[model samples]
Target: MSNSSLPEERELLRQIARGDESAYTLVFNHYSKQVFNAAMLYLKNTTPAREVVQEVFLKIWLKREAMSDVEDLTGYLFILTRNHIYDSFKKQATQLKAVDNFVQLQPDAIEDTDYRLQERQYDHLLNRAVSSLPPERKKVYIARKEGLSNEEISHKMNISIHTVKKQMQLAVQTVRSFVKQQLHI
Candidate 1:
């Protein structure tokens, strides 16, 4: 902090730039505690604070050549520390948003699954009821289900229109009652 130590710190930065491990070690020892404490205050966790300390020191070492040009080393380190904390908070927000989206979709996913299951049950019950119909009624019911109009069914089966309508009405009533009973609706 004093101007008296600036020359000594400059020499240390020069040594670090020239791949001097001892000078790098001295720099780490001098700054690591401060960096860790700042990180801990922001992150409120020991593990992440320690990680920030290691990352800050690693960046300082990796960018040692640029360090020599930094007139205010402490200010540069503070900026780096602040940027890293901002990055951590941004990453946490993104992860939480993804989790929230997934949570919000859960009920719709459950409802779709339940709907598919109920539809399958309804189809099975309808098939059973139709299979139990008498031969003449079953024939008329099948024709209607296959998209044939009442007149078309009458012509195809060589039956009168009135008979065709009567058989279809009975078939429909039978299926409706069976479905209502089986589904408890």
Candidate 2:
């Protein structure tokens, strides 16, 4: 953090700690795009990559005072973003595993058309439940499910960043509630 090296990031961190909007913008503009691109390499989706970048910046801003102590800002953000994306992928993989397990447990040769019909019915009901979401929530859910970020969602929908987050939260809560009731999970 000496004046000789990383002076720019140090200054930006200090200003950000003092609630400087311009500093936040500067840091975000400089590093967020890099973070987003890195995330996109793993996530393969703009929305998710954007979300990872926003989450990275949000964490930095919220913990700006401690950012000076961070040995390498770029390295820290890179690791944080990577971990978050990996965690998301893990969760998605778990959900898919459960669905696959359900399919595998069904008696295939014993029960023929009836089982397929029932599975189709379940899928139909799930689709209907998702479609019942409020428009914004549904949009956010689709974007988030596909690994989109708050920034990407906001840009795509032409809305404020905060609004996109709210929509994402609502979508999660609504889906969780519906899943509990429908699947008795």
Candidate 3:
């Protein structure tokens, strides 16, 4: 923990809370790599780790008001970093394209807020459906989606590969079923 980094980080967070772009840029350059590396330690994927880093900074800029109560800026960022990476895992498991450009890259025109609202609603339903899965299934789903290899997941969870695969399959099926039943689509 650099003493310079701590005060600099705290200042950046304060400026960011006021919607200052230069502060965000300065801070992003300073800490993005650390955030990426930390996330990569947990996520172990280049693309998702990068994406999570981008998201964490964006969220920090957007929600910097929470910083006043925070003691350690770096610690707060690490927690946010982990949460976003896990959310990327959930996004991968529940849908697809856990990247920034994917939405803009949608094949058809989604230039409507109402349509976007429905998409968000569907995403909510999907999350609820996932939450409703059995605990083992949810764990497997999160692990796999976070880019953990099946063998890694199996070893970490102390389960057999066969069991991991079965639980994942069951989780997928259950999520799909819940979506269909609840949303009729």
Candidate 4:
């Protein structure tokens, strides 16, 4: 436990509570790397660790008014970091289970040849649809397909995270429509 009475960090918390941007910047500069390291230790991925850092700070900013009451700010921040990492694991597990269930729901009797043909057809249609997207949207779509997080895609593409999400949503809808049309589904 760091000395809670340390004037620098305590004063930073005060300024943050008062909505000081420089104070927020100072806190972020001081703690961002530590948070990222802790997140990486747990999440084991650069993108998700970066996301954890962003989310922790965002939460701090949103809850700044309550900072004065926190005795050990450093400890509080780490608690938030651990909680966020745990939430990420829970979300990932749920997604994996859903994927497992979907796989299990597939017809067991579908022969290899028929499955391979269907897969090839879907791949061809998906490739065609992806190639038709505008350059930036296509990049976002490809990054998402490669399992990059929205934050990672946004950083790589020099765009806002919201834009990454919107572009991905549009790309998915367009591809789904195109594939459905081809399959008469």
Candidate 5:
């Protein structure tokens, strides 16, 4: 749709709009790495970044008719990827809130005691995990645990937001692995 797009690329888009599987495969092969790298810059993990890549491509396939009208294919894909990541973050937040609410709700006396004990054991394991983190990662993990946004952590630690996110991701993975190992799970 844009004058700047190469003739071959424009034809590729048109072919995609016409439901050409080979064209779609070409587009996927050409763009998947860019999409995945963009996702990794934010997600800081392979699984979620890979998920974003798949979801973005799936959307492109589902809405192939719109490909012809896209003025900038890369920009369109980036927007789709960014939106998906935002939705993922929002879903995670909602789930966390739901879990928090469930924890706060009163239960039968026996259930409450058992729940409390389990919670304490989990917390103790998590604390040990946190304690074992490297100093910088520990700070990032604690800041995040205290409910600081990534931006807030970045400012407080005088580091890039990307660093904050990466440190947080690594800290979480380490803590999860430690807890799992401790529980023999």
Candidate 6:
């Protein structure tokens, strides 16, 4: 695990620590495919796998100064990628649980008149919340609701993937806050 054991990677890390984009790019190009493949093996979806690659590299770049301290670059990247995927899974599970709770709170029979009325009211509130979003955020929110991936939204909107993610995050927060206010929840 000594620096001498990975002399080339050690040099790349040193360069990256000094804010060298070329060195960072070299490390990215060398490992991105492997990272994508590893992610695909677990995620079983191209979009999420691609997102993992982006997130892992972004973390690396952001923490470049610590790169030189990493004894094994490959091991460090693997840990980062694995941690991110686990986080994604946890977030998905939490969201699904929230939706499940919301559904469970409703009457069991959809044929109930009161249930139908409540459903409509909820839908109306949600629509209003969405409509109140900024134009770009609304677009991102709608695209996601339509089952488009972030990459697809980025390409369709001609924005960077990071921007698309940011917009979607902001849109969700805004809509959630608006709905909570409207529902007094």
| Leading candidate by lDDT | 5
TM-score ranking of the models: 1, 6, 5, 4, 2, 3
Ranking by lDDT: 5, 6, 4, 1, 3, 2
TM-score of each: 0.83, 0.50, 0.45, 0.54, 0.55, 0.55
Worst ten in a row by lDDT for model 2: 1-10
Which candidate comes out best when scored by TM-score? 1
Model 6, span 1-185: residue lDDT tens: 11222348889899999999999998888888878887887899999899999999999999999988987887787789889999989999999999998898665655587778988999999999999999999999999999999999999999999999999999999999999998789
lDDT values for all models = 0.86, 0.80, 0.81, 0.87, 0.89, 0.88
- Between candidates 2 and 6, the one scoring higher on lDDT is 6
Which pairs, if any, clash in model 2? 47-148, 47-149, 48-147, 48-148, 51-149
Candidate 1 local Cα displacement, residue 52, angstroms: 1.4
What's model 1's lDDT at 135? 89
| Better model by TM-score: candidate 1 vs candidate 4 | 1
RMSD of 6: 28.2
lDDT for predicted candidate 1 compared with the true structure: 0.86
Candidate 5 residues lying further than 4 Å off, grouped into runs, are 1-7, 106-185
- How far residue 70's Cα lies from its native spot in candidate 5, in Å, is 0.5
lDDT of 1 by residue, 38-148 (tens): 787788899998999898889888888887787777777777888898998899999999999999999999999999998998889999999888888999999999999
Q: Which portions of model 6 miss their true places by more than 4 Å?
A: 1-7, 108-185
lDDT of 3 by residue, 63-101 (tens): 777755666766777888888877767877766544545
